[model samples]
Target: LVGSATVLCTDKTGTLTENRMALAQVWLPSGEALTLKHGQPVSKDCRKLIETAALASDPHPSDPMEVALHNARGTFAGSESSSTLPIHTYGLRPDLPAMSNIWDDDQALTICAKGAPEAIISLCRLSDDAAQKVLKAVEDMATRGIRVLAVATSTAPDRQWADSQLDYHYTLAGLVGLADPIRASVPDAITECRRAGIRVVMITGDYATTARSIASQAGIEEGEVLTGSDLEALDD
Candidate 1:
């Protein structure tokens, strides 16, 4: 089968990338962007953003982005024990790609959420101008091959919990950019596949810009990107 194969289809994350993501950039609603470095101190607002993202993630996370958030939180803020435990959680759903966690502070209940920028932006219900600004930010990040996730916060009633995260009013805290570098062996492997007359194709759920960028790095030629919406609109 391998000898007869003419095309190879692949996923981006674990296939092309090392799958070890690192916190690389943060963009705030104020339009300020910060680049993070190892063993460096972060601004108070950036630290707060990292903390909130960590709160939104599971206490023990297996997902690459969640692990990156937790690692960033630990690097910037000494320990995770300083934060309060979550009282409730809204897991990611098919309809809503974001997940939110509610924590009870002494004064009130605090809600923190992190997920796809579009979903978080919708949850925050930003104005037309604000939403445009965020979409532009997401585009810039994606062009740089950064996987972006928007972070948000809100307050919940003391006695009542929302059945869905959308029920709460949320404020856009910021956007976190995670970088997953391409695997060292992928480029050479791709080149060899092409030499053998195999047509390589990459299929990913990532943004078009991101997919194109990674595809270029992995030595795959640029090609038409088909999104899920595009696929849905297509006919067999």
Candidate 2:
């Protein structure tokens, strides 16, 4: 452990936090924010947003013939979205929520939220603006060692009912992000890495501000990260 270094690599999509995106705010096309929860009857505003998201989305359901459903989300190697399936893609589910119109996995639920955080901070109904604040709050939560995700969903119709294909109104519930206190084993690992004189670097695509926020939470100070542009300048 003296002169050599071992590269301990990791993927960040979710292992750092929880794996499903949660619904934060429901912004109506007419510019109103609303909230909808499972088992609770849908609100007029929430239904509007969901209907629009669903109308604009293309959800690929789980069918027995599709062999790629078994693969993990975001990994397209042997899966459908490698340009081979012609119509398949997967994204990170930040706050995984359950709803009747939504498919469980491999399917993208389309429910868009809108608003200015400053305008909707106090409106419990919800707003895009408020959604951002909620996200900021999650970031704040992360600073305090909590993990978080943004969850939102759209519904066409209950899959269990007559026609799951029919598009209907949808709603925006609320935000769901997750986090946990720094685990005990991490300190030992950090100590080991330091003892070996190894430095672990974090690479992220989040905005510099967010990345810095996360870095500080993970005990990395300085609040600065090198972006591709920064790296280019360094090469010069």
Give stretches of model 2 more than 4 Å off: 1-128, 157-170, 203-223, 226-236
6: Cα error in model 2, Å? 10
Q: After superposition on all CA atoms, how large is the RMSD of candidate 1? A: 1.4
Task: Give a tens-digit lDDT track for model 2, residues 110-212.
Answer: 3332122221232234566755656565455444332332333443333222232113332343332222233344545656775776765656644455556
lDDT of 2 at 39: 45
**Per-residue alpha-carbon lDDT of model 1 for 9-116, expressed as tens digits?**
998999999999999999998888988889888788888998899999997789989999999998975566344568899999998899998887678889999999
Worst 10 residues of 1 by lDDT: 76-85
Candidate 2 residue-wise lDDT at 32 = 44
TM values, all candidates:
0.95, 0.38
Cα error, residue 22 of model 2, in Å, equals: 13
lDDT of each: 0.90, 0.38
lDDT of 1 at 175: 96
Top candidate when judged by TM-score against the true structure = 1
